[model samples]
Target: MAISTVEATGARVAVVTGGSGGIGSRTAVRLAEDGLAVVVGYTANRDAADAVVTEITANGGAAVAVRVDVADEQAVAAVFDTAEDRFGGVDVVVHAAARMRLSPLADLDLAVLDDMHRTNIRGTFVVARQAARRLRDGGAVITFSSSVVGLAFPEYGAYSASKGAVEALTLILARELRGRNITVNAVAPGPTATELFLQGKDAGTIARLADQPPLRRLGTPADVAEVVAFLAGPGHWINGQVVRANGGIV
Candidate 1:
């Protein structure tokens, strides 16, 4: 079910891509708590996405789960359509949908590289395009990048390259949308203790990376979500920049 725009007339609306994932889900909830109706967009995990929506609605917030493939223009368009149709107009778009594959560039399978780029690079562009077209005045577009793009960790060639493209486009889009009152930015997180980051990582590897940060711990999904919340809400002056939400690992 959709949240009628009339019921949420003054409330801002948000569309969070990959809302089933750790950071994405937290962002959806955070935005709801900040008084925005949200559209939780997921690729295949409808159950997970629905759970996010249920959590928000159970708390008396308005939210709906939308199924979308970020790389598919039509699917991404539908996500924006849902947000506008349900909650009036979209004011914030968090393009947190991405894929990460680790392999030395020389050893990486061409197909693996292709898959990562398709989702991380092309997918971001598809989402950005729609947000630019549909977002109401003073809206925000937040894309996901990786701190690894700067750290240059081994076996992160494909993933970092894709995020590099995201950062590159973020600045360009911000300029393209000049005078439109929309802020475009990218959030790059480092050493987060999320299911996605923990996968296939041994405890030793995790601990070592965690300690590298000045805070001496891995960043939590909530940590990154707060940054997203800022950009989506009050951080109006922060535009066309990449905010590193990595606990000062850089």
Candidate 2:
């Protein structure tokens, strides 16, 4: 279920990949609050995606839920294509889609590593390429990384590597898009209280994890989404940078 409303201010459209889950959904809603029509792209969980759209619409925001696999080039292209066809042109792209794997290097599953690479690294490039092709002048693109890249924690080696690649890609993409008046940046979140972070952890473990941060608590989806909202809206000078939203954990 996709919902779009007329905007008196002539709303710019944004495409948020992975707009069904915690951080993604929050970012989508926040962008809508910033007065942009949002295309909520999801891989699966169409119901969840549509629910996000419903909530945004109920609040008088414009949004649409579209199914897309970011790792697939054609699907990524189609996401932007549909957004453009529906809302004139896309002006912002926040890439919050990624997969995670937990294992020490010596015991790392090769298939898991490969999947992480495909989804995190290659998927970012695919979506960025589509954004480059479709996003209007003076637009913005925000990509996701993790604070694990800085902390180098055990069992996060492969994930860190994938995000490291993302950092590099974001920098270069920003440079490449300089002439186009588009800003490319990344946001690296740390230990957010989401389904992805809570998976397989006991209450004690989760408490310990939360306590490790200087703020004495894990980051929330809204925390990261606020930063994403800044980058997508008023953060024009913050290009080619990775803003870490980890509560000084790393």
Candidate 3:
């Protein structure tokens, strides 16, 4: 069934999954800067999520940290419930929770693939389903993908495949919400300087990727956060698309 946009009553609110660290954390803070109450969702890092909440509160913004396993439907529902309970309503949902495992197609173990699928693909479905059900009219659902889907980097097959599914879900959900005043989009960041990207790479490998982008520098969390803030705010006209936050690597 198509849900129409509802008139928002008070201050806007957002639920950012995986909001404990990296790009998610920065995006949560950025959304708070945009004057929206934020729900910081985390899977295991309670302290990191708490730090994000503290950062927002210290800045005079409102936020809460909720423990949620994105792959679990019931757990995700509770996260949203916390949002609506803490704030007035859910105006935005940022599905930034994903699991990345890099391995060549032949070398990838089935267990690792399953884990990635559970967290990345299933998690996206769970989060987007909840967002579609609960987000108010004029809401924005921003999902995360990776530029590797296009870059076709070696050993990124599994992670890229999962993110490709995310892209598909983003587009389909946008159409499903026909008359709803909400936007569903995915942000595919390139080789950003996030710990996830930097974990196993040496300096040389990092520099090589940084140079692939015309900008000649790795993206910062803040860089991607600006794009998210735009989609959450004035970029309403851009819908059902994958907005790559890459530095022209394509």
Candidate 4:
């Protein structure tokens, strides 16, 4: 496929934060498959990160793994630095590193809320700010949200609140970068079959959720990655939108 308007300035480099495994890892590979040099940023599990890099390299795609703490501006800055030094300027930034703890608001622990926001809200700001200042003339910044924000399910009050903040930041940043030709958007996935989501979930609960979507299946990491790849490569016009890649759950 020919490069879209988002690559007007030759946006061929991508950074995927929290990319050691799960959705982030898949996204890194997907972007690389689109011919972008990928920087896989992971906070821990270097082995997992190395594995991702290996897969991409084995596929003849350029990739490197960088350790990053989404909440640490300096660390995140380093991820961007590595991208420039190793590949070139960043053309796409996918912030997929986040924490989620489920609990009823009535029994929600304040400490848990603090922890989640520190990574979800503050971390998003640190990374998105860098993307805003450093992304090429025409590029994209994709953030992760959850369909629970719309579902209003039990035990998701704090989690959804944090994602709500993500949505707000995503929209405002898109407008803030109005003339830069950069697209800022968020992908809110629902009932994805990821280790993070499956932990502690009973089979009955999982089955119920899988059946809720019109498609009657849990979303795969590849499912959401495809959406991110579109935004990074060809779907340049879908700006400031919170795409519900939730299999019609909403």
lDDT (CA) for every model shown? 0.89, 0.89, 0.89, 0.89
lDDT of 3 by residue, 135-170 (tens): 999889999999999989999999999999999999
Model 4 poorest 10 in a row by lDDT: 1-10
Itemize residue pairs with steric clashes in candidate 1: none
Candidate no. 4 TM-score: 0.94
TM-scores, all candidates, are 0.96, 0.96, 0.95, 0.94
For model 4, the superposed segments whose C-alpha errors exceed 4 Å read: 1-11
State the weakest 10-residue window (summed lDDT) of model 3: 1-10
Q: In candidate 2, what are the lDDT values of residues 1-250, reduced to their tens digit?
A: 4655644246888999989998999999999898888999998899899899888888888888899889999988888877877787899999999998889899998998998899899999999998888789989999998889998988889999999999999999999887888889999998899998898889998998899889999999999999998988854688899999998886
The local lDDT score (0 to 100) that residue 9 gets in candidate 2 is 40
Model 2 ranges off by over 4 Å: 1-9
Candidate 1 structure lDDT: 0.89
- Pairs in clash, predicted candidate 2: none
Worst 10 residues of 1 by lDDT: 1-10
Candidate 1 residue spans exceeding 4 A from truth: 1-7
Worst lDDT run of 10 residues, candidate 2, spans 1-10
lDDT of 1 by residue, 9-45 (tens): 6789999998987999999999999999999999888
Q: How many backbone clashes does candidate 4 have?
A: 0
